[model samples]
Target chain A: MGQFFVFIKKEFYHIFRDRWTMIILLILPVIMLTLFGFAITTEVKNTKLGVFDPSKDIATRSIIQRLQANEYFILKKFISNPDRIEDEFQRGEVGLIIVFPEKFYENLLHTGEGQIQLITDGSDPNNAITLTNYATNIVASYQQELNKTAVIPYQIVPEIKLLYNPRLKGAYNFVPGIMGMILMLICAMMTSVAIAREKEKGTMELLLVSPMKPLVVILSKVVPYFFVSIINLATILLLSVYVLEVPVTGSLFWLIIISLIYIFLSLALGILISSLVNSQVVALLISGAVLMMPVLLLSGMIFPVESMPYLLQLLSNAVPARWFIMAIKKLMIKGLDVTSIYKELIILGSMAFFFIVVSLKTFKNRL
Target chain B: MQVIEAENLTKRFGKFTAVDSISFDVKEGEIFGFLGANGAGKTTAMRMLCGLIKPTSGQGIVAGYDIKKQSENVKANIGYMSQRFSIYEDLKVWENLRLFAGIYGIPNRKINDRIDELLKRLGFESEKDTLVKSLPLGWKQKLAFLVAIVHEPKVVFLDEPTGGVDPASRRQFWELIYEATDRGITVFVTTHYMEEAEYCNRVSIMVDGRIEAMDSPRNLKNKFEAESMDEVFHKLARKSTRTGD
Candidate 1:
């Protein structure tokens, strides 16, 4: 036990003593969270909208006023004819077009009914969806204002219930995903490079010949990274709650437990990579290039899994980060319990066990 | 007393045998020199004796432990320094000493004392604060040697320990080996420098994965009818056909 402590202290010194690694470990998570949360956002600002109002009446102008009052859109073009909507869309001059039909005001005043069509460019689905929703909300509010004074015999009233996120903010989605990403970065890539450095320097032989068992050597190398990742986890969680306003409505303790399990699995993977490679550059390349792309692209961190093809969806099932992102979303946003996250816990646990077994076997086999 | 005894210790990688049924004994407290050409099996035999790898078909005992059955025990009682200067270059000299000492299970209270003794004895008192990377090559080799045997193991293995050090430092390294042997620590040293073999109490020459000659440096020279151990080595190594390792 004392030996383990000594080894851990040595490992920590190695990590903290190197200024570059310390910077990456201590500051990189916060920087990434802040960057993604503030600078790199998916929420579109000043989206271009083309208004095609053939009615040229009071109700049409009121509807456009209501849409313009919101900050998400700017009326970039006013299409005189309905055919010009396609031209504006194709020219990329506008993302959406609102067409109020002819006699829109007269029909509304006489029968308390009118038709409004929303046409959006589908090239960018996320932008198109938001734009259409904004137009629908503006039209609905206009109808509500008219109904306060006028009589409408038949009305279609729809109530929207936002289950977890009433505001539907994008930061809430990325905070949990970023947590998984930064954990993988610190635990997997950093540790693999550190161990490979020992092998490159030929110190691994000295370690192997020492009385400290191989298991002890590997565990000691990974223990410091485990704690560092936990620190990263804590920092990211605090930023999500306090800065980004993404609360952990579920059990925070369970969230930490599952995340620790993930950190263990990532550290074991790092050791496994270290055992296979002999140089730090190769270790960095493997961990940084090979592992990073999959964690970013296939893990559904920034992209939705359902939107991917069938083959990719099946491929994502094999990515542990995808499940972790889902599990964290449940815990932080949806406020689910431990039973709700059991599947993710089981998968992460099995991965941790698998990596430990494989890395130990390879470590025994390799130099 | 023999600290290491190997009889018919063979290690075969598929069809090619690395150590071919060689037999030798290393006394408890003496420098035993192992010499070989580049492709010869000195490293393979040393690894087997250190219990880094199991022998294919042989019997061996190191530090009163079976090389195969008690591999971990053999490891616990021996130290190893590779030709690559296995010191952590990024670590300060004192920290390296501390790490190896800790690995050898030295008590925390005694670690600083062991380190101070080593620094004073190696004439490295001034370099206690220096990183191994900033030190000269000779000093690094010496510190690596000192750290390898810091646990006071019964036997220490040096595999081509003086490959790149200057002649002066090589001589100084041998003096450290003499100090280790005087303290009853067996030193199994491999070297490319033939003059280093003369310092050993006994020297064994390997050719084509087998021990071709084994005796004191003087006896081997006289028996080969050569003036020095260098000629004795050439006379035997000339028979080998295999190339670089």
Candidate 2:
């Protein structure tokens, strides 16, 4: 036990003594959280819209006013010529265009319906779809309000409810996902590279020849990283709550327990990687390519797993980050209990055991 | 007791045999020099004895532990200084010493005292607080050697411990090795310098994964009919390469 503490103390010194690694470990989580929180949004806002209203009437003006009233779109220009709409969208100055046809009020009075064309740039199809949907809802609501007084036997009412994310806040969705990715990268990737560095530098042989048992040496190397990863977890949670205003709906204790479990699994994975690879560069490349990329892409962090292709969905099931993201979402968004996440917990546990066993076996075989 | 005893020990990595069926014994409290050029099997044989690598087929006992079955025990009773100065460059000199000492389970007070003695003896007392990266290459090499033997293991393996040091520093380093051996610790060292082998009580010369010659420096010189150990080494190396074809 005394030897173990000594080894752990040395590991901490190695981590803290390097200014670059220390700075990166301390600052990266905060930077990524802030960037992803503010920049990634499911609810599109301040989108540029061009208006081509040829009918200069009161009703047409009222319809344009309703579109401008919504915060989702910012009215960029009112072009008299319809030909200018294509130029505005082509220059990327406008994401959406609203055209009110000639004699729009007269047609509405006579036919009880007016034609409005919504043209949106579909280069980024997801954003375009969102903007179009927002525009349609706003127009439908305005038409409904205008027709409220008329006694119509037939009416179409639209009911909408947001699933998964009710409030449609960007931070609420990204904070938990970023938390999982950052923890995994820090605990697994960093620790693996650090251990592989010892091997590359030929220090591992020196350490193995010492009286300390191999298990103790490995545990000591991982414990400091575990604590550092937890600190990052806390920092992200704090930033989410205070800076981004994302609420922690679940029990804080449960969140901590699950996050810690994931961190341990990541660290074990790092040790396993270190045992397999001989150089730090190889270890970093392997971890980033094999672990980090999949976590970011397939863990439902940036893209929904269900929305992905069939092959990707099947691939994501094998990624530990997917389970971590699911577990975190349940804890942070749904406020679920331990019992609710038993299946994810079991998978993470099995992965942790597998990595630990493989790493120990590799270590023994190398010796 | 023999610190190391190998009986026809061999190690093969795939089709390449790193350490062929070679046998030798290292007596207790003796400085055994393992001499070879680049690509020689000195490192592989040393690794097998240090329990860092397993032999493909053979029998050996290192520090009273079976080389095949009780490798962990063998590792516990030995110290290894690799060809590279493997000390942590980010750590201070004292921190490096304390870390190795702690890993060996030395008591804190004893570790402190031992570190103080070692620093003073090596004339590094003033640089104890400095990071190892700031130290000169020769100082780092010497410090690595000191740390390897700090736990006072029964046998210490030095793999090219003086590879890049200047003559004066090499002399100083050998002095420390001699001092450790005088304390009844066995020293198993490998070197490319033939002169360094002359200082060993017994020396083994390896070529193409086998020891072509093993004896004292004077005896090897007489057998090869050479004036110096260097001549003896060159003659054997050339003869082995000629026969290798």
- Which has the greatest lDDT? 1
| TM-score, prediction 1 | 0.91
Model 2 sits at a Cα RMSD from the real structure of: 3.4
* lDDT tens readout by residue for model 1, A6-125: 888888878877999999999999999998887787766677878888788988998898788778789887888776677887788987788888898888777667888889878788
User: Considering only N, C-alpha and C atoms within 3 Å, which residue pairs clash in candidate 1?
Assistant: none
DockQ of each: 0.70, 0.64
For all predicted structures, in order, the TM-scores are: 0.91, 0.88
Name the regions of candidate 2 deviating beyond 4 angstroms. A40-43, A49-69, A76-117, A139-155, A164-167, A251-253, A334-342, B5-28, B38-40, B54-70, B207-212, B238-245
lDDT of 1 by residue, B166-241 (tens): 8999899889999999999999999879999999999999999999999999899889999999999999999998
- Could you tell me how far off, in angstroms, the CA of residue A230 lies in candidate 1 after the best superposition? 0.6
B56-117 per-residue lDDT for model 2 (tens digits): 99999999999899987887788889889799998999999998888777888899999999
Worst 10 residues of 1 chain A by lDDT: A153-162
Report how far residue B126 has shifted in candidate 1, in Å: 2.3
Number of colliding residue pairs in each model: 0, 0
Per-residue C-alpha lDDT of model 2 across residues A33-65, encoded as one tens digit per residue: 988888756778888888988888987888778
